[model samples]
Structure formats: C-alpha cells, structure tokens
Target: AYGFKTATYILDDGALNGLSNDAPIEKLRALEDQTFTSDLDFKAALSNALGDDKAKQYEAILVTAAAKMNSVLILCGILLFVSFYAVSIGPVMWVLFSELFPNRIRGLAISFVGLVNLTFAFLVQLVFPWQLSNLGNSLTFLLYAIFAIIGLLFIVAKVPETKGKSLEELEKLLVKST
Candidate 1:
C-alpha cells in the first residue's frame, strides 16, 4: 500500500513538473533491464538471509566505510556552501561590471561578461565529471580548493564595492580608474 502510494505520488508530481506520464513505465523498464529483483517481499528475505550476527558484521563494515567517506562528504558540503556564496556574489559582480563601463559601453560589457560566464559554465560541466573520475577524491577536492581560493582572491581584488552608490557616482569611480 505504501509503495503504491509513493509511486502514485511520484508519478503525479513528475507529470506536474512537465515529465511525461510514461516516465514511470520507462523507469520500471530500466530497472528490469538492470535485472533488479522484482519481488516486493525482498526486504524481509534479505534480512532473513543475513541473520543477526552477519548483519552486525555488515553494519560494522558499513560504519567504517561511512567514516572514510566523511572527508569526501565534508568536501561536498564545502563545495555546496561555496556555490551558494558564488550565487550571492554573481549579482554583485554584474552590478560592478555594469558600473565599470561608460554608459555607451555598459550593454557591451554586460554581454561580454555573460558570454564569458556561459563559456566557463559549459567548460566546468564538461571537465568536472572527468576530473572526479580520473583525479580521485582527494585530488578532486584539492582542485576545487584551488579554484575557490582563486575566486576569493578575484572577488577581493577585482570587484569594486557598489553598495549604496548611485549609478553616477559609480560612473565617476570607473572614469577615475582610466
């Protein structure tokens, strides 16, 4: 009953979110292709197969594996945090980029930055999967740390403060830089 309810909820939600109603059937077929056991009672059978003593040993191994995964999890958490901060930084950078240009060139400057952002985003997506696969966990983290540090430095050095400044005042600041 619970499984049926969950499946119905998922199907309805997926349809509402613009997924085709065929999604659930396709997913089920994929699971069948992967040779997953279709028995709804497999949970009970699995517990019976393991027995109590073996289950305890299995649990201990899982705990040790989870402990080793802590570093990777922490790195992932940091990445998520940094990504959130970057989202906040984006608008500020855009505003500052806009302010740095003369009125006649502001649109051009914005378009240039937008293109650069899009290019980098595309490159990041292309590279990141290979980096994770080839570099292993620690090196992948080291790479992210290096990039994060560089981003922090760029923000500090290249980004101008724009808080509470009028567009005319910002223009004066940019003009003084020339």
Candidate 2:
C-alpha cells in the first residue's frame, strides 16, 4: 500500500512538474529496438570506445554498480514487507469489525469503515512526503507506530471471535446482540 501510494504521489508530482508521459513511452520504444541488437555488435563498439585500460576501468565501475544493486534489492525487500503489513492488517481489522456487527448494520458499518480507511490512505499519500521531509525517517515511522497502536486497540476492544464457526453459524452469530 505504501509503495503504491508512493508511486502514485511520484507520478502526480511528475505531471505537476511538466513531465510528459508520452516521452517515457517513446524512450521505451527506442530502447526495445536497441535491445534486439547482437552482443557482438555491443562488444565491438565497447572495445573501440574503451581500448584496453579504459575497458578495465569500465569493468570496475560495473562491479561497483552491481554491489550497490544488491543493497538496493535489500531496501526494496523491506519496503515490500511494510506494504504487505499495511494492506493485510487494515483488512483484517475491517473484517473483524464487520463480524462483530449485527447483520442489518454490517454492510453499512463495513462501508463506513472502508470510507474511513480510504480517507486515511488518501491523506497518507498526500502528506507522506511532507511528513518525511519535516519529521525525518524516525518520526515518520513513529507516526505509523501510533496509527498501528490505535488500530490494534480498536480491534481488541470491539472485535469478537469468529474462529471455528461455519459460514451460516457466523452469520447467525453476527445477527445476535453482543
């Protein structure tokens, strides 16, 4: 969720900053044509440009870039985990709340819950960059921690167990008064 929100924010900012979407599409098409060229052609071009000693230097740069790429991959993995936790916990809490409500109000309650969740999500996307810029990484994470704590508290207080119940049983259970 965070990753998706970040991407949306970046794209929106790019549009605001006068980045033409078609420019990237055109650039990608040009890259597709170059990708079909043979490795022999690429090697010959490289050899002509770099000679021998410069080629060794280029190889060293490639190795350095490769090492940095590993660190990049690790950071991407951590971001993926954060996104998974955000999306998973939000739905789990929503489901738990829905199960606790009576059948007649469950749909309305779920819809209201969804609206609240989406509003927060939209605000998070809009304000995250500002938060990061002003508060820095530690305080940004602290805000998320506060949100998680509140959400957990709400879930513990209002959610009822649905474990080991069949679909019909759960439905009937929800219909009963708490």
Winning candidate number (TM-score): 1
Give TM per candidate: 0.54, 0.46
Q: What are the per-model numbers of colliding residue pairs?
A: 0, 0
In terms of lDDT, the poorest run of 10 residues in model 2 is 4-13
lDDT of 2 by residue, 87-161 (tens): 877457776665665677878988898899899899999999787645644457567768877977986886657
lDDT of 1 by residue, 1-178 (tens): 1121121111122222343343233322222212112122222222344554543444333222212123455656677867887787666667667777778888988999899999998998999877644553346656766887899899789767888888888888878887
How does each model score on lDDT?
0.52, 0.51
| Global local distance difference test of model 1 | 0.52
Query: Which candidate has the highest lDDT of all?
Result: 1
